[model samples]
Target: MMQTVQKRRTAGFLLVISGASLWGIGGTVSQYIFEIHHLPVEWLVAVRLLLSGLLLLTISLMLGNKEKVTGIWKQKKSAGAVVIFGLFGMLAVQYTYMASIESGNAAVATLLQYLAPVFILAYLLAVRHTYWNMRDAGAVLMGLAGTFLLLTNGELAGLSVPTEAVVWGLLSGVALAFYTLYAGPLLAAWGSMNVIGWAMTVGGAAVSFLHAPWNAAWGSWTWSMAGSVIFVVIFGTMIAFWFYLESLKYLKPQETSILGCLEPLAAILASVWWLHVPFGLYQSVGTCLILGMVIYLSLPQKQRAKPAPA
Candidate 1:
């Protein structure tokens, strides 16, 4: 039994790492599609959401679990939170990330977006008033401070960054935090598939409106565009998310999230290899610090014991 448990945990860790790596590659891949294909950010995101959501929905139907849709809708309150999470968390984050990249560099945007875990820890402790011991608090602070060091080029004073890009990146962090927290309760009641499907559907619809897909130049679809779309749909969105959900089955949420800290590092590597972007020394140090904090945060808390009778 212990061996089986260990094997499951190891598999879960691998799944989470794989998922994070895929997600990391997304920025570089999307940037390539946009630049090479001359596609609009809104249009690209719209297509991604529509295609990915449809594929997941089809898979769910094939599995004879179409009932999750109606079941999710029946719980109107729960559905609302799911919508918020998918819209602001998923859709909005995508938008902000694209905007940040366009307005600044992928490196900066990626680092800023990774601050999501910090925001999540803070929200849990400060707003929700959750019981976070000293270690947890310290972990959060270290992670956030490291992220700051990474983004600001290791400068503690007088940082001159683009305001618009910073705003978008910060917004992405907030959305990510909200999604993580909100998904927990909603998933507990509605299950991951139902909640994720509904959330994706609603979020996709909202993005469709923003992009006005009907007005897009569909004639621009070439072999390259088709290939890019297929890659994004299959590997980036579908497979990555599947791995993420699977990992959760065997790993604790914090443990999985800590492993997710690899995402930015993966993104940096992808950017360098695929896009020929340079990774700065400051960013590398910051990435290590962020990873350290994640590990710290993921450590299991020591439990107080009851006294035994003599």
Candidate 2:
């Protein structure tokens, strides 16, 4: 039994890592679209969300999963939560993150977004009234310290970051935290595909309404743009998220969260290689520390009581 559990845990960690890696690719891809194509951030976001949502919806329908949507509206509370997740969590986070990236460097924006774990810990403690252990507290401190290092390029004294970028980055973290926290319960009630698909649909609708995608310059659409959109929808959103949900069945939430730390690192590397973004020595050191903390905090604690003989 113990061996089986360990194997499952290992598999889950791998899946989560894979998902993080795909997500990391998005930063570089989005940067390419933004810089090379000179596309407006809002318009890009609007198109990505709209197309991704439609693709997800089509898949769900083909799989005959209409029950997930129908049952969602029947339960008022769940429906409300889904709406909130779509609006405040998905939509808001994506917008803030895009804005942050546009206003500042990708590395800076990514480092700030990684603060989501801190927000998650705080939300668990305050809102859920969950007690924190020494491990949790240590992890939070380490993460924050690591974030400071990564953002300030190891020299905390010579930091000269912009205020607006910082604000947007922080907002992105908060929104992501809400999304992660809300996801577990919602997924438990409605499967991952359903929750993600519906949330994307609603969030896409919201963004479209806000940005008015119809007024954008759709005339400049090229094969590269279409390819990026296809990749984001299929690999980034659908397949990656599906893997993530499967991994959840095998690992504990904390364990999965710890593996998710790979996301920022992946993003950093992608930015460095694909976008030619340089990472200072300080940032490298800070990122290593943060990744270490995530792994430590995610380890399972041994029970005080001895196990009974088989």
Candidate 3:
């Protein structure tokens, strides 16, 4: 039994790492699709959400989870929660992330999104009146300091990237926090696949109505574009979510969140290697500070205080 538990923990760690890496590299792949293929951002987002959602739902059905998928909507509260999550949390995260990547490269966009933890910590302290912990405080300071270095790069003259990218990136972080907070109860009630699948489907359908996927010019589609899209849909969105959620069975959410730091590292590496995006000295140090803080927060606290009851 002890050995089995150890194996499960190991599997969970591997799963989370693999999932985060896929998402990180997937962002780079998305950058290629946008820059090289010049695919419309709206169209790509719509199709990706829809296709990934359907694929997840199909997988759940194969695993004899069709009842969970179909039954989620039968309850009024669950259905309403799904709609809100779909329209607000899911749509917000997707749109803001794509918009950030559109204005900047994937590396900056992803790192900015990681700032969600800081935002979440702040909200918990200020709004929720949660007790302040020194570790979380340190994490917030490090995250902010790192973000400052990354954006300004010690240049007092002007911002590194366009102001537009910064705005979208910040918004992406906030939306991610919202997504994490909003999805908790739903995930408990209906499992990750069911919640995510329905949310993605609803969000994607809403975007599709506006973007009109059919209107996208098919002449632009090439082998490279096809490959990128397939990878993003399958490996990036579907498999990544699957592994990350599956890891929850063995690892605590906090551990998984810490392991997620691998995402920014993977994104930065992909940006540097594949896209040849420039990385400066100060920016590297800044990223290290942020990652270190993340690791710090990930460490087990001997007597961590319990969160206040909602």
Give each model's whole-structure lDDT. Answer: 0.74, 0.76, 0.87
Q: Which clashing pairs does model 1 show?
A: none
Error of 2 at 94 (Å): 1.7
- What does candidate 2 score on TM? 0.84
Q: Which stretches of model 2 miss by more than 4 angstroms?
A: 1-15, 156-162, 250-255, 302-310
For residues 130-203, what per-residue lDDT tens digits would candidate 3 score against the true structure?
Answer: 66877777888899889988888868798887788889999999999899888999999898999999898998
Choose the strongest candidate by lDDT.
Answer: 3
Estimate the overall C-alpha local distance difference test score of candidate 1. 0.74
Span of 10 residues, lowest total lDDT, candidate 2:
301-310
Sort all candidates by lDDT, best to worst.
3, 2, 1
lDDT of 1 by residue, 13-107 (tens): 99999988887777667767766776777877776776677776677778788677567767778667877877877788778887776665565
The per-candidate count of clashes, in order, stands at 0, 0, 0
Model 3 clashing residue pairs (backbone): none
Candidate 3 wrong stretches, greater than 4 Å: 302-310
Model 2 residue 258 lDDT score: 74
What's model 2's lDDT at 204? 78
Which clashing pairs does model 2 show? none
TM-score of every model? 0.85, 0.84, 0.94
